[model samples]
Target: MRMHKVNTAVTLGAVALLTAAMGTASAAPPAGRTPHPQPAHPVIVDCVWHPQVRPADFMIACGDGNSSLSSLRWSHWDQGSATASGVNVVNDCKPYCAAGRFHSYPVTVRLDHPQPWKKNPRVQHYTQMSLVYTDGRPDGFDRVVTYSLWN
Candidate 1:
């Protein structure tokens, strides 16, 4: 009788342990329902800037369903003179393919100096701009476009 009781107790303990483990597993959130704790990869499809306006504004529209924008940088060049800087502005957009969910971020870009043309007028100046999203990953969204500016 003593041996039988000991065996029964051991079996009951094992069953309880198994049951607890299963319950914990079942309580976990379902796939695609959990939030990503880190910034996801950024997908940049296109980036452009307009240099014709005073206090020029550069706009970048990009998306990374899994990541959030932390900062942005812009760079440009004209005739061999190159300039690069960061801007502080509002970055907001929806996920590339997902609807109803949108993310907004704040970024900063500081221009080294006003366009040389702005200070010493020039004719039809040409410039190229590129934007870089900091804290960007390579996965999550299909595409991301970021708009920025330097005033």
Candidate 2:
């Protein structure tokens, strides 16, 4: 009789727990409160393969760290495209790379051609990066230059 009572008690406890869990699972949000959806914002994949949004500084040349963008002021960032104005700093390998001088130029940066990132298929990353120099630019560099960002 004691064993039968224990079994019945265990079964009843399990059923009660399951019923409470099901009720909680199907319950709606609290009164006067609605769930907020998450934003599907686009990003820029950095050299180390990380998604970044409105980064202040970004390296252009991943190989030798010769070219980079700094002091970025992003005016717009969305799924279609992004625009920013920053300073492009380039290392002038004058005599040698080890002993190089860095130069900064006023530039407007535009990012487009977004696609799904390889590492994270659900995330979108900018594939194209274009820079238009507003003032003096680096030697041997054009007024407008475009590069392919790593995904």
Candidate 3:
């Protein structure tokens, strides 16, 4: 009985220690890795009609809150259509002011061919931008943020 009690104590102590470590890790960035700054209203550059073949990574600000899409790389693109994947990094502002941690979730974005905006026949814009998440969605974010994109 005494031997069983000693084993139980050791196991409980180890579990507690591990749980504490995990909490700390989540509360802050992991050691040796600096946190990347998230910008307010990140620009989706050249969002006009037939944009200048931007296969490079770009940021998209949803404008609803602090979370934004970061680091999009197009894996495929042809004839004004493109498919890419990126990350949605969010500021989890918990506890109080300035005590926030950023978390990244995998997401996929699609840009459809441009069409003339209803308001202006001369100006054109991508009719839609589809954002589908692969993992770790922030609270209140839909699995897909497919919305109309206009100039």
Candidate 4:
């Protein structure tokens, strides 16, 4: 009888604790008032391999919404691969450069070995990008900028 009573008490205590915890847990956004939606990931254009290919003056949109590569001109694009050159216009927030004026520097761009996108496997990504600063490093930037699409 005592064991049964103890078990019943323990069960009730557990139920009460759960109920309290649930009540204290974050509530869903007030009915009809939805939370702010997150920004969508920037779609990287498959310049070389896509049916509608864009070889020269292509843009690379980094999902982070900060930096992008522009004026990309592919010297040679064949067999689902490409070697290109472009300018990376980055926000150089340096000792004094981040005055809302983006800086541009020459960069070599490469695309190879298409892979499926992380969110949507139906779409493909270059999976590799090698940005080499040919005209020397910017005033406040690194010498080389390497980016892996899938990563």
TM-scores for all candidates: the values are 0.24, 0.74, 0.50, 0.50
Off by over 4 Å in 1: 1-56, 60-79, 87-122, 137-151
Compared with the true structure, the alpha-carbon lDDT of candidate 4 equals 0.63
The full ranking of all candidates by TM-score, starting with the best, is 2, 4, 3, 1
Best by lDDT: 2
TM-score of 4: 0.50
Q: Estimate, for each residue in 1-151, the C-alpha lDDT of model 4 and write its tens digit.
A: 9999999999999999999999878668778885654223222454333322444454455343346677877676654566778887776655544355677888888777766566556545566667788886656557766666643
Winner by lDDT between candidate 4 and candidate 3: 3
When summed lDDT is taken over every stretch of 10 residues in candidate 1, the lowest stretch is: 38-47
Cα lDDT tens digits, model 1, 1-151, are 9999999999999999999999988786877776423212111212332233223334443333333323343354333333334442432324534443444433333232223333224323323333343444233422333323222
In order of listing, the candidates' clash counts read: 27, 0, 0, 0
- Candidate 3 residue lDDT tens string, 23-126: 98878777876575422211223433333344454435444345666677878665466677888777777754268777888988888866654544444445
Model 2 per-residue lDDT tens digits across residues 75-151: 99999899999999999998987899999999999999888888877778889999999999988889999998887
The candidate that achieves the highest TM-score relative to the unseen native structure:
2
| Candidate 4 segments whose C-alpha is farther than 4 A from its true place | 1-52, 55-64, 95-98, 118-124, 139-141
Give the total clashing residue pairs for model 3. 0
TM-score of 2: 0.74
Whichever of 1 and 3 has more TM-score, that candidate is 3
